[model samples]
Target: MGVFSFDDEFTANVAPARLFKAFVLDADNLFPKIAPQAAKSAETVEGNGGPGTVKKLTFPDGKYVKQKLDAVDLDNLSYSHSLIEGDVLSAELEKISHQTKFVASPDGGAIIKVNTKFYTIGDAPINEEKAKEGKEKAVGLFKLVEGYLVANPDAYN
Candidate 1:
């Protein structure tokens, strides 16, 4: 098992609550609309859109990943989730964990942070390579969310 983590921070002019609502709460609807290249679509599986909810994201290559909400803190704008199941990368990944948090900066903007952990068996062909792939995907996601907030100032009401 290999452990890997990636962290990224983005300063968005949008409010924290607004950014959270669009990126985390309404991801099923908003992500596809903004980042069609990366996330073709998302569907809510278990719950509505809160803690314990399950969501599956479909990529363009016909592969999908399912995530189970582990924790949610609306006060701090943070949440954690683990990979329940997926064919994200060659079907060898057994477990993956990710957490996202939001902080309201003193400058009246919001900072978004993401961390990821991946685990695999012995000597997989793309162990570290897969981790790098995940980092790139995260960058793409941030760009899409940032672009959306930039375009729609009134999105999170």
Candidate 2:
């Protein structure tokens, strides 16, 4: 198998703790509500949302992915998950792991850092186009969440 990894960072005008609560802890319920175009719904299919829990995210196009939670550190504002089953994985990927960290900024906002590792099928290289597309979607989701928080300052508090 081949593997490729990349990092992305985003700055938002939201507090780290609140953003972490909304984006990391409550994403299953918040993401779809905030960005219905990208995510139609999200549900926990197994476990209680901690490590080893499996969550499914359904998109507007009817495609879905099941991801297993690898780690979650609320105090550190970090989380990790691996895509275990999905149409996206059925193509050319063996698996994909994502780690995200949210740090407090001096301005009271937050800086979110994302690390993604793509594991490809045997002898096949990771698709850069797909990776780029995924990054775009992730950024869009973050922006949408940030906007929601900005508009509702009492949210996620």
Candidate 3:
């Protein structure tokens, strides 16, 4: 098996606490409502909205992914999850884990840092293009939430 990792950071004009509440905590409810074209819904399949919870995200095309929440720290504005099962994982990928951190910036916004680790099957090397695509999707979601918060200043406050 081969293991690969990628790190990415994006700055958003939203507070860390608010962003965490909207994007990390309430995403299952807010995402689909705000960007229905990208995600049909996100629902908790097992456990509550906490660590060890299983959440499934369904796309508009009917494809879905199941993720197991590993950790959540509202105080630190960080969360981690592992992809337990999903159509998003190709045949070459055996597992994928993600960690995200939202740090408060001096400007009252936040800096979102994401770390993704990909484990490949057998001798198959990790696909950089696919990894990049995943990162782009995350960025897109963040932007969508940021835009929503910008439009409604009182939201997630």
Candidate 4:
């Protein structure tokens, strides 16, 4: 097995707490409502949405993903999860994990950091194009939510 990892960072005009609230804490409710092109719906399948909680996201193509929460730190404005089942993993990947952190910037905004790890099966190397595509999707989602909060300042406040 080979593990390929990467990290990405983005800045937003929204505060960490508000972004965190809308992005992490209330994602199941806020996500599908805004990202119809990505996911048709989202729901908690098990646990109380804390550590070990499993969240299922059904995509518009009728495919779905099941991710288990590894950690949720409200005070620190961070969360971690792994794609345990569904689309990606059942393909060429052995596992995929993600960690997201949000910190306050000097400009009263938020700086978001994302770390991703892709485990490939056997000697199969991680596909760079697919990895880049995944990163693009992640950034797109972040920007989508950021745009939503920017359009409605009262949201997640």
3 or 4, greater by lDDT:
3
State the lDDT of candidate 3 residue by residue for 1-157, as single tens digits. Answer: 9888888889999999999999988898898999998899888899987798998999999999999999998779999999979998989988799999999889999999999999889988987887888888889989999999999999988
Candidate 2: regions farther than 4 A off? none
Q: Model 2: what TM-score?
A: 0.95
Measured by lDDT, the strongest candidate is 3
Q: TM-score of model 3 relative to the true fold?
A: 0.95
lDDT of 2 at 35: 85
Q: Give candidate 1 misplaced runs (Cα > 4 Å).
A: 89-92, 122-126
- Winner on TM-score between 1 and 4 is 4
Candidate ranking (lDDT, best to worst):
3, 2, 4, 1
Candidate 4 per-residue lDDT, tens place, 1-157, comes to 8888899899998999999999888888777889999879988899987799998999999999899999988889999999989886646698799999999999999999999999888878888887888788878888889999999998988
Candidate 1 residue lDDT tens string, 1-157: 5555667676777778888888777888888887777788888889877778888999878889998888888888898888878886456566787888988889987888878766665645446676778777876776678778878777787
8-44 in candidate 2: lDDT tens per residue? 8989999999999998888988987878888899988
| Model 3 regions more than 4 Å off | none
TM-score, candidate 1, is: 0.83
Q: Find the 10 residues in a row with the least total lDDT in model 3.
A: 126-135
What CA RMSD would you report for each candidate? Answer: 2.4, 1.1, 1.0, 1.2
Give the alpha-carbon lDDT of every model: 0.78, 0.90, 0.91, 0.89
Clash pairs (backbone) in predicted model 2? none
lDDT of 2 at 141: 84
